[model samples]
Target: MPVPAKRRSSSKGRRGRANKGLAKKTLAKCSKCGKPTMPHHVCPFCGNYQGKEIIKSKVKKKAGSKK
Candidate 1:
């Protein structure tokens, strides 16, 4: 195997790795509940996709304090 003729600079290495950093996720707004969600995917909050309801979400009741 061949080795490098000289030591690589930290800035050069960092420049090469610049594109390897994690990118921000792309999100889209849900048509039904108006929540942020991934595009072309089912909405978790309203369970809607492409103007249709894919899942039937259940309403949770709030617990009352006992007197």
Candidate 2:
């Protein structure tokens, strides 16, 4: 059994737990387009993540009537 000379500070043990909050990126910026995106998720502006297309936004082509 190990004994501490004085009161083992809670700060030492809190490093791992408290540091986790500060360890994460609050907002992930998109590389394709400069927009704020959530971590591990596709960018809403660029629709990409992890060098792959994740969110597929469709654009409807307009139909032309023959005269």
Best prediction by TM-score? 1
Cα TM-score per model: 0.58, 0.42
Query: Where is model 2 more than 4 Å wrong at Cα?
Result: 1-25, 58-67
Model 2 lDDT tens row, 6-62 = 875788778757766666558988877767888878887656888777766332112
| Alpha-carbon lDDT, every model | 0.81, 0.68
lDDT of 1: 0.81
- The residue-by-residue lDDT of candidate 1 on 1-67, one tens digit each, is 9989998999999998988977999999999888899999999777789999888654211123333
TM-score of 1: 0.58
